[model samples]
Target: MKHVLLALDESDDRAVAQAETVRDLFDTEHTTAHLLHDFTDNFEGASVGQIAAVRHAANILEDAGIAVEYHETSGSPSTSIIEAADELDVDAITIAGRERSKAGKVLFGSVSQEVILGTDRPVLVCSRRTEE
Candidate 1:
């Protein structure tokens, strides 16, 4: 895989870390990971906190000899992730899942769910937020 987009959120270290693990498993060079924090304004402003998460992931992956680059974009986390993955022509996507309350799921539609349903590329989901 040339590019792998890893979906992340502000309090979601679990998911970002899992995404990096998938990148390692693939042994893909030229790996680029995109994290979409949030969208601001009416398509004009954006708040992408995933940049830090991406950098954190890159450090882990790079130490293992995997090349990594990360991008922070703005928009609905799910929408931004899919768009970025498509833009990058990602071969696959890795995502970490955290527990979401009923309200959280309702408001966000669950990022992991959205990425799995929306993308043509393979998505590796790690269910760890509640995993033992």
Candidate 2:
């Protein structure tokens, strides 16, 4: 049995939609859906990593018949996400993929890229146009 973490953020329509999508992508029985959110003291107050957001996303995963363990962590988004994956020793990680704008890419760098390059585990990046 392997654990699969469904990384979530404040993105739109994640509730049932994203959870079900992940459930179908990975086996729920042999897998545990781990949801992690990071809340940091950014200039805009506490953000996606907040415990409340993680709790909200966890509820959605549960509704989809996926057994999930969720956590709210403090730290950089990519760093903490990788740490969570390491802690669980999951077989893989499933995260939403976004098309990075040139400017955005240059400034903040890429979270997905960072995670993908930093970890040895295979990362399944979910995108609308991506093929299973």
Candidate 3:
């Protein structure tokens, strides 16, 4: 079975778009998606499944016949994502990319960019656009 690590933030649109990318690009019946959410701070013992965006993405993936697993952690998002991918040995990683200026990226540090550079596995970056 194909394994994909879907790293999600708190944005429903972005999470749904990432889920759609996996549904459209892989064989849903034979693929497994591990949904990972990193709470950067103030998690207060919350779980990944409790997040709205994560729940939305999970529903979409499940509806498409994809097997789903939930993972939650507290730390650096990009570091957590890369470590999860390595630990899960996922075939690919799917992440949402937001528009950021060079200065913004340089200052804020793009999680997607760091993840893309950190891992050797294939990465599918979904655009922020949700509309057709």
Candidate 1, residues 1-132: lDDT per residue as tens digits? Answer: 466666666544764566557555666565555543444343544345334655566566666666555466655778888888888788877776666787775543477789888888898775443366
Error of 3 at 1 (Å): 0.6
lDDT of each: 0.63, 0.68, 0.90
User: After aligning candidate 2 to the native by TM-score, how far in Å is the CA of 29 from where it should be?
Assistant: 2.2
Error of 3 at 103 (Å): 10
In model 3, what is the error at residue 53, expressed in angstroms? 0.2
Lowest lDDT 10-mer window, candidate 1?
40-49
lDDT of 3 by residue, 1-132 (tens): 999999998999889889999999999999999999999885377788889999999999999999999998789999999999999999999988775787765533378789988999999988655358
TM-score (all chains, Cα) for each model: 0.68, 0.71, 0.89
Which lDDT tens digits does candidate 2 get at residues 77-127?
Answer: 888879999999988876766556877644433777788888898887765
| Candidate with the larger lDDT of 1 and 2 | 2
lDDT of 3 at 47: 85
Clash-forming residue pairs, model 3: none
Q: By summed lDDT, which 10 consecutive residues of candidate 2 come out lowest? A: 12-21
Where model 1 places Cα greater than 4 Å from the true spot, the runs are 28-52, 100-109, 127-132
